[model samples]
Every structure is written in C-alpha cells, then in structure tokens.
Target: MERTILMADGQSFYASIEKAAHPECRGKPVAVGDPTRRSGIILAACPVAKERGVTTAERVGEALAKCPDLVVIRPRMQTYISVSLLITEIFESFTDQVEPYSIDEQFLDVTGSLALFGSAERIARLIQTRVQLSTGVCARVGIGPNKILAKMATDNFAKREPGGISELSRANIEEKLWPLPVHRMFMVAGRMTAHFARMGLHTIGDIARLELGEFKRRMRARMGRQSDIQAEYYWQTANGIDPSPVVSGMRSQIKIINHGRALKWQTYRTFADIEPLMLELLIEVCRRARRYGYMGRVVAVAAAETDGQRSSGFGRQMTLPRPTYLEHELSSVVRSLFLTHWKGLPLTHLHITLTDLSRDECYQLDLFEDRSRLIRREKTVDAIKERFGATAVIRASSLAPTAQAFERAVQIGGHFA
Candidate 1:
C-alpha cells in the first residue's frame, strides 16, 4: 500500500444535495434543474430516479420521455453552494492539502496531515461523519495512492458501504480494476471510450499492455503529445506514483455560472431557469463593482447554447445614480440590465459581465438621493451580515431567493441562482 489521497464525490452529488436540503422530495423521483424554454438541462437526479435512468444532462423533455412520472425540481444553486462552502471549511480543519475539484468534489492530499488524524480510514470516517452531521448529507469517499485511483476507487465502492469510504490497493486493483472495461477508467468519458472500443481494446489492462508506438499507430494516430503524455501519466496513476502536493495562495478567481442543460439535439424548452441563473450572475458582477470602487461602463449578458455557440446583448453605458458598492443597490441595476436584453433562447450557459471599467466620482452619485446615507446604512448592514453570515441580513426585495443564494455565496462558491 502506498501513502494515499482521498477523493470526496458527492454521492449522486446534485441529487443528494437536493434530497438532503428538501426532505419532501427525497423518496420520489426528483430531478434538479432549470428548465428554460431555451435550455432545460438536467443538473441532478436522486437515487430513485437513477434506477429509472434519469441522470444529469438529460433534458427535462427527454427525461420525461424516458420516465413520464419523473419529478423535475428547480435547483437551489445558492443553497447547494453554501453547503459546499461549509464542506470546504470542514475540510480545511483536517488538511491543508485540499484541492477543490468542483463545486461538490474535492481532493485531499492528506499525506502530511495523516499523523494528526491517524490512518487514512480514520480520516475518511471522520470526514464522512462530520459531513453527515454538519450538513445532513452523506458523501462517498475513495482512498488510494493517487488522486485518480482514489477518485476511481471511491466511485467503485463508496455507495455500497454505509458511509462510502472505499479503499483501493494493489490487491484490489488487480482483482477489481484490471478486469473492468477500459471505458471504466475515468477521463475516458465520451468519444474516447468509443474510439478505444472500436479498436478492440476493451479493458484498462489491455490498453496498458500495448507499446506506445503501436497504441498510437493503431488508434488513427490522433492522440496528441499531451494525450500521449497523459497515457504515461496514467500508468503512474495506475501504479500510484503521484507525488503532486497541493499548493495554496492562488488568487481567488472570478465567479462563473456555467449551467448546462441536456437538450433534444441542443435546444431549450423554456426560460425559467435562465432567469434565476442570470440574476445570480448579476449579483456577482455588482459585488465586484463595489469591491473595485467603481461602476462599470458596460453591463453585458451573454448566452451560450449547448453546442458552444453564443450570443450577447450590451447594455447602455449607464452610470450609477450613486456610485455605490452595495449589493442591494448594485444588484437592482444589474437585474434591470439582465431583464431588458433577455430574449430567452435555449441557452446552456448565461453569463453577465461588467466591463469598460472606471473609478467612482461625485458625478455618478445622486444629488437628491441621500446617497451617502443609503450606502453607509447598507455598508453597516453588510458588515453585520459579514460577521453573522447571510441569514442575518435580508432585504425585502431579496427575501424570496436570497436566503439560500446568499448563504451559498459566502459559504459555498455557489453561483447564486
């Protein structure tokens, strides 16, 4: 056995979060998504739904075709995000080598922190228990000698046990992995699997047995140098030679709302989901506006279809009535900007951007508006909320969706939908 890393997969991830957050939707077939007329992408499906072949990225319409009684639920992106953050905080308590893989997935290079926590299984159990206790959600953990193997191992055995902490070792790899289909080796999703199958290379062990030159020559010779390099890297992964340690202090990147809805050959069915997603994006844009001490010269909303084609609308160079840094005021303008240009296409992704940047000045503030008082008051509110967290501060306008969305913003790197 080699020193191991741990991978935490959300165990049905989106669906699990939805079920955990909303108990009433637990038992039945629940699918979380935003079914806009333009793009009704399925984000997650619960365990029951999984049995019915309802999974993420299946369109609301296609899913219905498969299971007529399927229950589709609008996502609480904000809430999910908040839970994600809480999970992150909890993870930090255990190890510094935590790499956030996605909103709901993370990799813990617990090599150094092993002594403080004890064995890998102890830490895995600790993380699993704490997650269940803290968020009322259960996670499936995979422990192995490298990130890839750990992730794959978790996926292999996590859900079978009570609190999924599946371990993969040389013995298990030989017994369980070498025999499985090559497509089962992750990162081999989509077309990669098809290409391999056509060549009669059916198992990971089969692919591993071939010479690099023969492998490349036989496979239509399109495996790029990077792919070739990855092939070698994967052997290290299979043998568990990964030594990459986590590094921190990277600048926190800009926020993004990347929603992908499955489609009937890439088309949207409605517009409801995009509305909230756009609203969420606007919130981030405004928050950034305030942080940078200036209102942007442009407000833009762009939509990308499932195929990666995109279209966007540009707002007028509207100056803020009061050059302000308040989410309440700034988001109001952002909301207006988004709505005006929203034509509602089948968009898989909606992005709101603020550019043509400039600093704040007196001319931007409203003379009759008591601007200073409002901003000051809002600032106080922000400070209070920052201290006590989002649930403490709720504006009347944001009362409906803001609670879950805001909680997720500070706590989870959730896109506020």
Candidate 2:
C-alpha cells in the first residue's frame, strides 16, 4: 500500500503559546525570551514581530531596536509542553503511528487512518483546524508518501502559504521539488552543498540526473566511505522515493540524559561561586537517572566561559570504578573534574552528562562503599520528590543565595513557569 505521512509543525510555537495565554498580545509585535538578562536572545517571535524584522536568537536589545514597540515576555516552557501534549493527543486520535519530531513538531502515518478519516488532504485540513481551535495555535501540515517528502513539503511550501497545507507525491516530484536549490534539500550540509556546487550540481534535478555509479564516485571523493550510502539516499530523496517508516515510542532507546544551564548573567568569577550551581545540576541529573532506572559508568562535565563568542570552555570525561546512579558519587567526581580543570575564568554555562549506560540492575557492588544502602536512600528520595514535588527535599547547599535549585525546580526547560 502507498504510504501517507503528514508532518505538523506549530507556527511560532513559543510566541504563539504566550499569546494564547495572554489574548491581549494578539496582533501585536511580541517575542518570548528573558528580557531581564542583558544577553537574552529571542526564543520565538510572533508574525507581527517577524514582519518588523525581529528574528529568533537575535539579541533582545537588537530585536527591540528593530521594533521599538515589541512586547517581550519570558518563556513558559511548561505551558508549551502542555499544549504540545494536547496536540499530540489530537494526532493520536487520528493515528497510532505518531512520532514527535520536537516540542512543536510531529509526524503522523495516516495511511491506515485514510479509510476512516477520508483522503490525506482532508485529514491534513481537519488536523490543522482542530489544532487551531483547541490550542489557539496554528499548525502547518504537509502530506507526502514518506517522512522526508512530508517534512520538505512543510518547510518549503506549506509554511509559506495561507492554507498551511501542501502535498508532495512521486508524480509531482519533477515539477514541484526539482526547481528548488540543492541546499534546501533535506540532509544537504554546507560542505556537501559546496561540493555539489563545485561539480556544477546546483538543483535537485542536477543531482537526480546523474547516473548512480557516477554520483557515487563523486560523492566518495567528496565525503569518504559512507559516500555511496549518502549519494543513494540523496538521489532517492531528490526523486521523492523515501521508504522510511514513521516510528513511535522511540525514546526508549535513549542512551544519555544531560542537563545544562547557561547562567542568566556572568556572575561566577571563582570556583566558590560555581560549586553550588554545579552541585544542583548534579542532583537533578542523578534524580533523572534514578527515575529512569538507569546507571551510567561515565560522567562528563563541561564549562563555557563568559565571552560572548564562547571561544573558551573545558570538557572532561571520567569513567567510574563502578556504574552509579547516586548523586553523591557522581558529584564527587564532578567536583574533582571542575576544580582541576578550572582556570578562574568567568563562566557563562555549565553542563553535566551521564553516559556509558546500562540497566540499573546491571551494576556490580563496590568493594568499599555501602552501595546498596546508598541506592536505597536515593530511590527513597526520588519517590518523595516524585510524589510531592522537586523542592520537597532540597540539599542544604542549594539554600545558599548563589544556588539556583529552588528557582529551577519550579521552572521547565530552564525557563520561567
């Protein structure tokens, strides 16, 4: 059977959610970000702000200079996640084969649902209307025979039009997809684009017209051993011949969980000022690791200095004598790593990563530590936090004025609310 996949992406997601929560901001120039921080960047901008030349990741001051009347609001990441969950639920009503691409984008395999819901275009329109009416956020829907084409149709066509729906099929590949620049095609990196340009291949049609062997030869010389695979994939994509399936419940395969925070201001000038914050991050990371019933053998710590260019940072990784999910064990190693590597540089960001993962039950007992007791205590703490709230139990160090744990516990994705 011919597949029918749809990609649905929320338009100006963060700004839209802010507007939805505050109806007064509608039709006004608005952006979502931390306006209080000097280095704050625009996370998302409404259509009005976009029309005034305000763009995402642009500095707040610059964005204000572009549109003096712009309304700046802090991001409420929890609210956006709630709305995304609602949108995902709506997609699930249409098809079980729904794969979330991000916080504001998802892919749905509606080939099976077509028999009950009508044609692909009809389902696309229904989903768009449903999302708008239910969430007060508009969604652009793109329909295609496969995931790549659906995403491309969304990015290149649907997002630019009033109807907010577009379709790409094998029959219209030449007329609709070929005229676009090669750089616009999915998975075409800057180096690949430059290589293609050097070969006088500027459009999707140019690449599609090359013989498989000749294309593979050129790609090998340009990209190395994986060139044959990359060349074939790109050639097929150019011809609208994707065969990948839309997958759901894929998060089970995650091997690492990390948490990083870029400080609101460059306030840490010494390790004394930085230690508490790093401890808080370690606690959160360990809490998550225990919650997921996974233990990691490797701990990686990274720090980025305060320079606006972020040219200086240190990253170091160490393997534990035994895998652990306890914060105490991980924090000891982290503290050692930071103190040894730090050069008294004013830091803007800190991150902790846990990797070399295995199931929690796979760990071997340490010869010196009371491993079982520590594991039990950690699990008990996790249970309390899960049942009550993140701040129900806090480390005494977190109570220090410089620490951010109390503030972070109530926020989502390191943003307000």
Give lDDT tens digits, candidate 2, residues 1-417.
789999999999999888888898878999998988747999999998999999999999999988998999998888888899899889988998899999999999998999998899899889989999998889999889999999999988899989999998888878998999999898887988999998789998898888888888888877787778888998988877877889974434559979988985467877778888999889888988888878999999998876555457899999998788788889999999988887667888899999988767557877788788888998898899889878888888888777987776766536744
Largest lDDT belongs to which candidate?
Answer: 2
Question: In model 2, what lDDT does residue 261 have?
Answer: 89
My TM-score estimates for the predictions, one after another, are 0.55, 0.61
Native-referenced Cα lDDT, model 2: 0.87
lDDT of 1 by residue, 1-417 (tens): 455688887766667777776787757887887655315888888778888888778788888778777777778878888888788778878876777788777888788788888889999888988988888767788988777778788766775767578887766776767677876776777687777777777877777667766675655455645566766654555444566655531225333322222233143325444445455456555555555455554554555544345544343334554344545554566567655655555555555556555444343556667767776675666577568765475544344442235645555545543
- Over 4 Å off in model 2, which ranges? 251-417
Name the lDDT value of residue 164 in candidate 1: 79
Candidate 2 lDDT score at position 295: 91
Using TM-score as the measure, which candidate wins? 2
Worst 10 residues of 1 by lDDT: 256-265
